[model samples]
Target: MSALTKQSAEEWTQLFDERYKRTAWPYGSAVWGKKEWVCPDLRNESVVSMDEGGSNLFWAERFGRELGMNDLWVKLCGNSHTGSFKDLGMTVLVSVVRQIIADGGTIRAVACASTGDTSASLAAYAAAGGIPAIVLLPRGKVSTAQLLQPIANGALVLALDTDFDGCMAVVQRLSLDEGIYLANSMNSLRLEGQKTVAIEIVQQLDWNVPDVVIIPGGNLGNVSALGAGFEMMASLGLIKKQPQIVVAQAEAANPLFRAYQRDWHFEPIEANPTQASAIQIGNPVSVRKAIRTLERHQGIVEQASESELADAAARADRTGMYNCPHTGVALAALIKLRKRGLIDARSRVVVVSTASGLKFTDFKLGYHEQRLPEVNALHTNAPVELPNDYDSVRRAIDTHSGWNP
Candidate 1:
């Protein structure tokens, strides 16, 4: 840490820029490109990477225009090996496990209780590193695409007849055995890689900080990880200003939002089911860390109902984006805040899209079919049914699209 601090901020920035341009083995990876800042002690041979990070910071031009803003961006974190931001962290966790085993450590396997993305990432990274993985999931809660990831990666998948909180409880107990290492965000090692997202975002934007960054919240570790990155940059003079962080959550599972409403007095509740199933956590393990981050960053916690999230996601999709329901939660929050004039129209805002919409095919199909409960499906784009004839198809398309031909 002292050695890095000794270099001027300009030198550090130039070093990072140079590393990013390199096509070397680990440097090609966005996380390992900043390895000195992330895990300097970990050897290159021990690093498990699928070149995660360096996801697109997309310009939401049409979507922003709809919200009366011109500077809206979405960080597509899901465009990775496992189709979620969890890959950013799992690479680091699995690498550390490999290093420990190489050093004669007695770790047998790594395990985690996941709503979805974490297990997928851990399984893939563990497989890549030749380490075994065990994943406990709340049966019937996760999407089929998410459920299949760990199974495909050869992890010992356990489908428990319990909610995420229950699975979390059991995994914590299981990790009491020294051979079974916990791979959840509570482990802290994962955050070392996840924090690199913030650095990457700034780097993509030429080291300029955004005015606001809104991220979907579930177990809440990512929020703190995001904060850690910005805080580290400020400490090292990489950024002069910090963005106001916003944590968006599903109303059905919004303990953090409730806490924020009650002046930061937190209490866990039995979460209700929502389309944003990934974030359907009743008791988040990283609640304290999240609170500290929110406090330091002037954070705001906002929630979206099932209908709101569905509509918001569909609306964004209409503007050429395939947003997951969790991204919808953040989008819905952005809409509400914009309507309330809390966010300026010209402010540069970035919403972190945590997972790929491809994983939520059911949610997308349900919305388009207008079959999702409580959702109006305001932007439904159902296909036009027609007889098996060219004339009929042309007529249907003309009528539906209001085209004269």
Candidate 2:
């Protein structure tokens, strides 16, 4: 474990050059690209993966133009096997569990408390590796699509009556048993996998680091993971600079944002329900790691209200990107930062889309139908009813779309 932390710039660079150039998958996986840096002790056969990572670092030219930033990009982490960035971390966590079992460790099942994505990813990877998994979820909190992932993967899903924090506490206590292992972001192994997003971003940009990177914050693990990735890159001579990171949060559940507002005097909050359900974590387990990341990287924490996040997601969808509400939080934060002059319109930026928009169809439908409470649908493209006639259809199209015939 110390080897991962104590690796010098020269040693890291050597490993990067050797493995990063591989054409085969798993080796080509950004998380495993520098396998020596990630899980070096595991043999090829011991590795369990769905070829996660290598997600598209898409150039959001239209959306960038709208924001007056020509170099804006979206790291589409939603494109993973589990349809969320959680797959990146879960692959690593579950892989390590498999390696441990192979090495004579006695673990019967892996368990985690999830908002949605974590359990989905964990269950899928554990199933792939022939490992049984137990998932704890906040009852009626997670999206239907998210809840289905773990269930479909054959995990023992337990829907706790309390919120995610309660679920976390239960899972943590359950993992105390020697037969079960915890697969949460608190585990440093997951950070090693999540950090590869940073490596992949720089790699996709031909080794040119971006000026700013914004990611949604719930657990705060990703913030620290990204920071760790950049630190490792700089330490390994891969890059000369680190990006100014922004951890975007939903105002309804923004403990880290509130901490930043108080000049780093941190206090956890009782997170309220929000449309960005995936990040509705009040007391994040990785708050300390996130704070350390902020201190080291000159980080910024920004919060987006429900309406702002909804509007931002809708606006981004118009530009050909179907964004999850969590991604909306990051985009809203980007807008807020731009207004505050923290992020210049001219700077190259990347906003991480944590999960697929398809997972939140109900939220999207409610927004377009003007049904969600407290959210003003500023750009609704609602379907107009029409009679089944050419004239009626033409008139509805002309009226709704504002195109004169």
Candidate 3:
């Protein structure tokens, strides 16, 4: 099937109304709420869900004010069951695989190549559906927390001595066999589920569309997924206008950004190590689809330096948000656009935070400690170390609070 189909406005309106009123298990899911829009053929019993989606769209009042934008919002996709946006897609992919197997299909296991979040979400959902999960990961590239998830979920995790691109190649070859079902975003089914992020955003805003939407780009699947969502809504008259989409990338690993700069022509460069490990992709699988979406939306691709991303994450963290490094990359791009008047102060914008900061605790800790290389700790709030003496502790407190000792 194509990325998305255009539905009649009347048909969509009826479906939207039905979705809003649904209070059942799978239908209650924000992703599955628009079941007819996503995939309506699957039986409810075949669905495997942890009631994912319905993440908050928080008004970043302080952060927005700092940027002179009054209507900036952050989509907290990290607040899901698996602590990442991958949960939105994984549930659909695994559920469909289970259904196919239940109908006497010859699939033996579901497999995927992941950086971190995908493996975690895929493992959890596959485990829930009683399906064997096989995950291929770049060895020592993923964080401890991210690697631990698949291990805990009983996935057959293979750590290969290569980058994400290498792992992806191996998985693609393995999935050629009918016995191994592919669970990667290269499969349109996963993109179908991930597109719900865009749908849920409009629903949260009373069906009003924002002026701009910024997302972190990795495998490029999300770029197309988001575009598909808005296109579907526009086709159905659910939204009158389409937002200017932006794909943000870390400077160290920015193949899409390089292509955008050269008028969509470039050879893939070797991806450098970035703190945002999830987006460290040299050759993204969905590049062509992402390019199409970008052209359709007049999209912008921006890169954020290591210091820029780290500083942006640190600054956003101060405003009661523990943003992942990937979010920092997007936030930094938004900041650049706003500064250059590409994104005006009056426009309503939503920046998608892909994963939870908890997954990259070491990255956060290194930044706070002023330890990460090339990252400017613009707002460090390191804890004070005091000796084991009442007087010393009192003096340290007094010094910190500006009290004359």
Candidate 4:
């Protein structure tokens, strides 16, 4: 369902703003875009996000004063049903799954590999939708909030003694299992839902599009899907200009950076070490798509160092953005590119903050700028107001955070 299928512009506009507020959604069976939407076959396969009002405010360039739609406008894909941009994909996938079940399908479960947000979205949805969800989380990777979703939603949460790659291995194995469905990037239905971000972005801009879109690269599905969205938008006459896309990655695992530099195929990486754990992927599932999309639209890939990411994370905190290390990496990359004159200052830039920093509840994005405390003084609750002499401070110290051990 797309704009052309609409009886009037007003009706299409209403559907475009569905994420802006909750109301009786009547466009369930109607086609609103150039693609067929899908959701899990639960009680109703038509459920969608009821976006609060003012998503339009974000769409409008408050960064500008006149309120006129410039050549570009920012789209907060993060405003999806699940809080993170994954909702854009999950909503549609849920609908599709529900619909398939209604048709006497034998689908038994859904599974995915998540750094944090995607697993939560799937768990919450599958739990609410009465579908069994199997979430494979990397060992010692995600935060408590990230890990809580599956347990809270009553899904089978498997703490893989592995990283995202290992979890992905399990997902691929499950996908091969009879009656098991993998919800990872392998499912194309999610992309249909994700395409709405671009569609709505153009609609919000009053149809003005960007010259470039920057994404924090991990599995790289979103970045690749973004290019797909723009191409479809162009075909549907949703936007006027095609934006060159750019990807940001941690220098610790600069596979994309290396690939771009050598003008060769992006080989799988072996080890990626960065504070930006969310985007720490040695082998992204959608690299081919990412490469193809970049070729079609002429995008660039860049890397950001850990120190730079930490500094930017602190800067975001200072500016009230309070982003996670993933976003920090993107911001750092952008700043570096700007300093190097790689990104034109006048070019409209959109950086995707995939997950919130608060998701990490315990871990922090930025590092200490000053010299770190000594081994005996790392406790947060340890007293630092001791006498000037280091010996006096040691003598006056209480137990470590009240831990007798």
Candidate 5:
């Protein structure tokens, strides 16, 4: 740590950029590319990586035009091995566990309670490291794709008849047993990798900071991790300005947003079910860390209704972007903030897309079919059925396209 502080910001930037360009074993992986900043003491062979991080920071040209903004972007963190931002953190957690075990520590298995993405990421990384993994999930809450990933990876998945908070309780208890190591975000090792997203965002933008960064919050660890990245950069003189951090939440499960409304007084609620299942957490373990980070940066917490999020996602999907429900929450918040004039038209803004839309096919199908509860389905597009005739097909196509004969 002291060695890193001795180097100037420009030196660190050059080093990171050079490492990013290399195709070496661990340097090719973004997390390990910044190993000195991440897990400095861990041996190179002990690291577990899947080339996580370095996700695309896409320019939302058409979407920005629709939002009346000229400088809007979406950081697609889901474009990774496990198809979510969780891959970034899980790599670090599992690598540290592998290192501990290799050093003669008696860790028999790694365990976590997840709504979906976390379990999938942990399972995949643990499997990659040849370590046993156990995941506790809230029964009937997670998407089918999310559940299948852990199962396919051979993780001991327990579907408890409870919500995410309940499952978290059980996992916490299991971690008390000496043999089972906890792999949740509450473990700071996860944040070491997750924080790399912030660095990557700045790096992708040529070391320029945006005016605002909005991320969908559930467990709240990611937001804090985001802050940690910026804080580290600032401490090292990499950046002089800090962007306003915004946290978007599903209104049904918005404990943080509620706390923000109440002058930062926090209280856990019984989280109601929402389509953004990955963020369906009510009592987030990192709430204190999140609040502290938010207090440091000029932070705001906003929430989206089910209708708002679904409509926002479908609306953005029209612009060639596939968004998960969690991303929809952030998009909806952006729309609201834009409408309220809190966000300027010329300000550069980036919305963090937490998970892949492919993982939530059911949500997409439910929206288009107009089946999801509380969603208005304003942008729903259903397939048109035509008879097996050329004239009939032509007529249907003409009608749909509003073509004149």
Candidate 6:
């Protein structure tokens, strides 16, 4: 129920006042005009798609009109090498970190606490760089695919003896150790990489500005990065207007929403096991930046019900878009905002589907099990069954496939 549509509408004046004194690589006229010495490995484009993301900035007007949204066309970033929108941030981040290390910058190992998506994205990138990842993962919380990512990608995945918070605590300690660099959403480099999504979205849509852009708010870094990207775009005159961003979060872990509502000292959730595991953080590391990103843009964090997440998942399946529960939570918030008149038919909506649905084991698609098939048969889709041991699983596989594993 908390909103910042008014405050965000007027945040640029303050941001403008502060932009003069900043020294970030992405900011300032000097940095913008300078020829970046790090020659991008264009050959890498062979392995990764050289998609036209920024080019969409050119068609903002066309998209806005077609979507029936006034001066607002969504520049989507959810489509990337990794399903979730975190790839853009990670790619740019790896580039910077790689260049620094190449130029005599010293660093030990890269570490992070993953909630399913971020860890997967980070693991793949870290592996590609040949950097041994010290991944701290909470026990039994991450999705199956997320859990296997580091293993499949050849990174050292350590199952922590605790929850996501405990893993983050370990990462925070390592950040100061100088023996490892924290690679969570809190790392500004991740923000830098993430900002490119906005750039690509605007580029792909011919640079027309969307009336509204919605982002999932977890540790706050993702949305904050997006806001900063749009702000940079406006400064570069890439587009005449920028979208007013709206953030979404689960009701169970909505410290930002609660803080915005109470307008007092923030008291984040102590813990949560919400369906939206990607956003189940108790205290967002990017707290201040997340709040300011919203406050500066007149945005709001809408907390959606878990049932809404289920409904949204159903909608996604109906639309032929399969995503994990975290994505469903984002869509749920979108629907909630629309129902509340915070968003309307007049507003063209772009919901970011964060990850592939295959990652989840618990959430169900009616199509997957129309009759709520027995939980015994529920796991039948896994291709192997066991009588409580690997030998049994092997026997079942041999019986089913007439072969050995």
Tell me the tens digit of each residue's lDDT in model 3 across 34-116. Answer: 88778888899999988888888999999999999899999999999989999988888988998999999988899999999
Per-model TM values vs. the true structure:
0.98, 0.94, 0.95, 0.79, 0.98, 0.73
Which window of ten consecutive residues has the lowest lDDT sum in model 1? 396-405
Candidate 3 error regions (>4 Å): 1-23, 401-405
Among all windows of 10 consecutive residues in model 3, the one with the lowest summed lDDT is 1-10
Worst 10 residues of 5 by lDDT: 396-405
Clashes of each: 0, 0, 0, 24, 0, 30
- CA shift at 238, candidate 2, in angstroms? 0.8
Query: What digit string (tens of lDDT, one per residue) describes model 2 on residues 1-405?
Result: 356657765566556556663667678666777777677777887788888888899999998888788999999999999999988788888888898999999999999999999999999999999999999999999999999999999999999998899999999999999999999999988998999889889878877899999999998999999999899788767799999999999999999999998988888788899999989999999999899998888899999999999999999898899999999999999988887888898899999999999999899999999998889888777777767799998877666752211
Per-residue lDDT of model 4, residues 258-340, tens digit only? 88898846788864556677677788888887888888878888887766776665554443455677776776776777778
As for TM-score, the candidate ahead, 4 or 6, is: 4
lDDT, model 2: 0.89
TM-score, cand. 6: 0.73
lDDT of each: 0.94, 0.89, 0.90, 0.64, 0.94, 0.61
Q: What is the lDDT of residue 160 in candidate 1?
A: 100
| lDDT of each residue in 106-225, candidate 5, tens digit only | 999999999999999999999999999999999999999999999999999999999999999999999999999999999999999999999999998999999999999999999999
